[model samples]
Target: MSLDRPAGKVPLLELEGLVKHFPFRDSLGRRRGAVHAVDGVTLAVPRGSVLAIVGESGCGKSTLGRVALRLVEPDAGSLRFDGEDLLALRPAALRAKRREMQLIFQDPFASLDPRMTVEAAITEPLILHRLHRGRERARVAELLERVGLRPELARRWPHEFSGGQRQRIAIARALASEPRLVIGDEPVSALDVSVQAQVVNLLGDLIRDLGLTFVLISHDLGVVRQVADRVAVMYLGRIVEEAPAEQLFLTPRHPYTRALLAAVPGQGGALKLLEGDIPSPVSPPSGCRFRTRCPHAQALCAEVVPELMGDAGRESAGQAAHLTACHFQDSLPPATPIREAAADARLARLQSFFSTNREPTA
Candidate 1:
């Protein structure tokens, strides 16, 4: 649970102007406007580090992950992996390149085949990649042990394992290829709180031990804080802020980023609760997508789009690279600390009551 930074080197994944739109159709199949699921996303994943893409639901983080793996074809973008053009690759070549990149989905049960045994499931990738073929069973046992599961559990089916176990199996499958890059789209969100911590630690260990580059997509800031070396805050299919995890959390530049940090429990700050529902992506606001709900929005915000820029005044190298996409980012009012003694007392009483009344574990 240390907040130490990752020592990542060269870029493993490079994406520029990535765009993916899902078009809507009428009853008669008439094409209508498209859903801007992913729009102009530009990012880089450094080798042997974890970069987290976080935002509210439907901000296109999931779609961006799938698009990175080519699970969903992007309409427009430049994707380069390890100095090779991903978009220019043929089908057969792309299939071969997949061994270098893999995805760990959110729901372990849904992603895994119910009928497949643990051995069959974990070894499928090994078989596909034609690795350790003659001794696949032994390799499966090794992978099981690597993920903190017993070798004998290879005989068990998906139904017999707990939620965390299933996720471990999924992780093993992803690692069976010995991929250089792994994209985890809400991989730990489905597990219980206690189980979530175990999986998070497991992933952190795997990434460090295997020298893997990770892109974690999640809405949970707490989870992001645990594993990410860097973070990108997305809104309406665009990244509004990108910075080192500690710097971003300590001094958030964008108003939206500040609002999100304020919402976390015990993180005392003025809670600037965002007003109104998120606008439909199909017809997002013309200029700043978040202007509709931004407290500091002005007439200029509606007429011009702000580009993501690094902080010019920050002296620290890491803080200097903190990017924020707001025209008046420097002018935004600082958030005051929340001071509600009565509320804090009430919350403490409620927590104590819950702890006393909780059911004992077996």
Candidate 2:
């Protein structure tokens, strides 16, 4: 399923100057300030790549995913999919274009319709797009098996399945339209740890087998490390750093990114905890949103915003440039590197556990 895409083609998905804000109002109907969910996000996802957006709760990771799929429209920005302008598509055109994109929601428990059987649920997409017109049940059965569920289970109710199975069904439904891009918003977070590993492995296999351009939104670094090709670290609705997963984990340049890595269990660096609570998105800190919690904050960090800096010519061809947004990144003290051997060993153990047939370990 992994196709060789032509070189220098337009990205499968591209977002620029994206902005979304939720406004609150009193009973008086006066509009209070808005919650700045996403502000000026720009990124590209090449075909067949897994781009993970990682951040703490309310940092706009999920919002960005929703916006990318246009499930929640952005207040401002340009969205291009396969060189076509998504934002400019008319309503009917947008609906037709939606067949190429889909979303797997965070909570599998609530994602399914309680009233609908698994067959009906998965068949909804087929009906919407007028696909497999006379053989919907067979299609549902195929989808169930694709996600590692029994074909017989299609007739069962969602409540009859466990959390992991429910998530598998959700995955099947998202793929019913055979979308080219899928945004998984914390798809594994609601499941238990053992189940999480199984779902993560399934997702990885599907991405490789289906050649999906996937966007995974999660705060779980372990899962991100396992599946992501590119990692974007978001803070207070702004991306602080983005790079290839290995480069970001091994040589994180932004102080915020370093602190996040330091908190991982096997990172083998002196813990570098962020000092303060994240600033409220309603009124995020000026200049740099992370300066409030960033250990390397200086007078300049308060006065001016830093652009995401990277040398385009330095990286090997075809590898993404490692970009970090910090004015003093060059002058800041070098971060302690994560011990590679320990990290590799831990990752190896995790992969082994995922591959084994034995019951999941506690």
Candidate 3:
């Protein structure tokens, strides 16, 4: 993806301090509490770029994507799409703007309407936008082939196709309205490994072929590294680190970011074993959200929150100069154990630590 921007080119999408909270009700229908699904998320995606948001489940990545696209309203903050204020839009205007933004969900099996034929599924968006009328039939047929499905499959239901093909159909439907932005939330997580690659490759081809800006939410590091131009690491409800794909892979700054990298299937060789588990989002630890899981935690780490991940300069020794957030500047080295042996190492270390350490306090 092209990184250079024209002198005055505005980002295709921007979210400043976006926040979302889902309220939970008791049996009496009284508001009991709220789930902080997304909090203070800020990001910008340039035109024709793919920005992948990576984090474990329940880290608020998907919620941020939905809020960015206005699929869900934010509790606070700004969302601008194509220079228009998303939260400020009226219902009718927002509905109209929906044509420019679409979402590709995670589940290919359950996301589709079982009763609808492939033709109807792909043409619904086109019909809603009034982009094509009597032409929808022909267009559906063409889209089927464009997504690598035969025209004969148009009459069939979603259950009739393989997972990969269904995902392709989903892609076709997302493209039906000729949207400018597509938020793909774990688009291939539900498919087989090989099929996952197929879907990812298809998305990569589509993004390049159509010049579409994508906000990809995924937990798959390999896929993100391959398909994303830039990557954002989210923890709890905030972004801890972000950088170009190559840079992040080569060097991650925040302790949380390091732990996340270590957790990747083959990233362990790049660092020592990670220290702890990610804290529950509902009750995140005080100060640095990641301190509870970070091995580098110290008195100050628990008192002062780290900034966004960036490179070394003022940050701790291990942090990259451009890394956005890091509290310790120059003392704490990065934890890179190389990933191949991570699982075995982690297991061995866990066994040894448990054997040597005292029992947990109840």
Candidate 4:
């Protein structure tokens, strides 16, 4: 959570120029335009740190998470994990690499097999990786306990557990392989507000205690604020801003990011609210995808695509640089503090609950 950590170290996972598109076909079976799910996204997650990718629904946050783990093949990109080329790996080699990376999906109900008992579900990974061998049950029990669930619940069916408990089981399954990196796509979004905090606290503890690198994909800014070390703000399949969690929340540079924070209930700011719906990904705006809704958009915004550039003027000594994709980020009017007298103070109280040293409970 500290912004003072020095940057420039090699990351555990590095993705560059990543692109994934889902093409459709006409009645004649001929190919039509593709849905630009992820376009030219480059991001890095340092070892033992948490990077949260935040955006509204359909901005390609989930697709980016899947592509990062190679569950979805990218049309173009360079992906390196632990300093190795991920794209060049053969199927068999990629299967082997799966042991080091896992995903905790969004819907726990769909993620778990109804017929499979809790133990069987959690042990599947150990079986696939040829781990724990004859000790699979023991390992499953240990994993169950680690995620703050009772080991005895291993025999229960997925349908028998509550939403939060199912998510804990999903977490246990993700960690069964003892992965070096885990991508959680909306991991706690479906849970109740109180339950979300419990799961977030558990994840924070596991990431810290076990030194696991994590990439969180979620729209819940409160959850992101509670656990993320850094945050990437995505819009229309592209990242518009990236900065340390505290810095981004305090001084967002991109118009899209500022609007997002301002839209949060009880937060007051001078920024204009976004006016229109998000443009279809199949045919996004020519240049800046967000220009259509951005109040600061000018004629130049429609002609030239803005590149993500570091804000050198705002960087503090030894802190990670804040990067913004707005062409006139420097020339733009300064942002007023978004916090208002009636600002949602509950978020801070909620964050403190999950961020403390107290142990997680069921």
User: Which stretches in model 4 have alpha-carbon errors above 4 Å?
Assistant: 1-9, 268-271, 340-362
TM-score of 3: 0.87
How much is 336 displaced in model 3, in angstroms?
1.7
Worst 10 residues of 4 by lDDT: 1-10
Cα RMSD, model 4: 3.6
Q: Write the per-residue lDDT of candidate 3 for residues 214-258, one digit (tens) a residue.
A: 989999888898898899988888888888887777767677777
What lDDT does each candidate get? 0.87, 0.89, 0.82, 0.90
State every prediction's TM-score relative to the real structure. Answer: 0.89, 0.92, 0.87, 0.92
Ranking by lDDT: 4, 2, 1, 3
Query: Stretches of candidate 2 above 4 Å error?
Result: 1-5, 266-270, 316-319, 339-362
Best by lDDT: 4
Better of 2 and 3 by TM-score: 2
lDDT of 2 at 79: 90
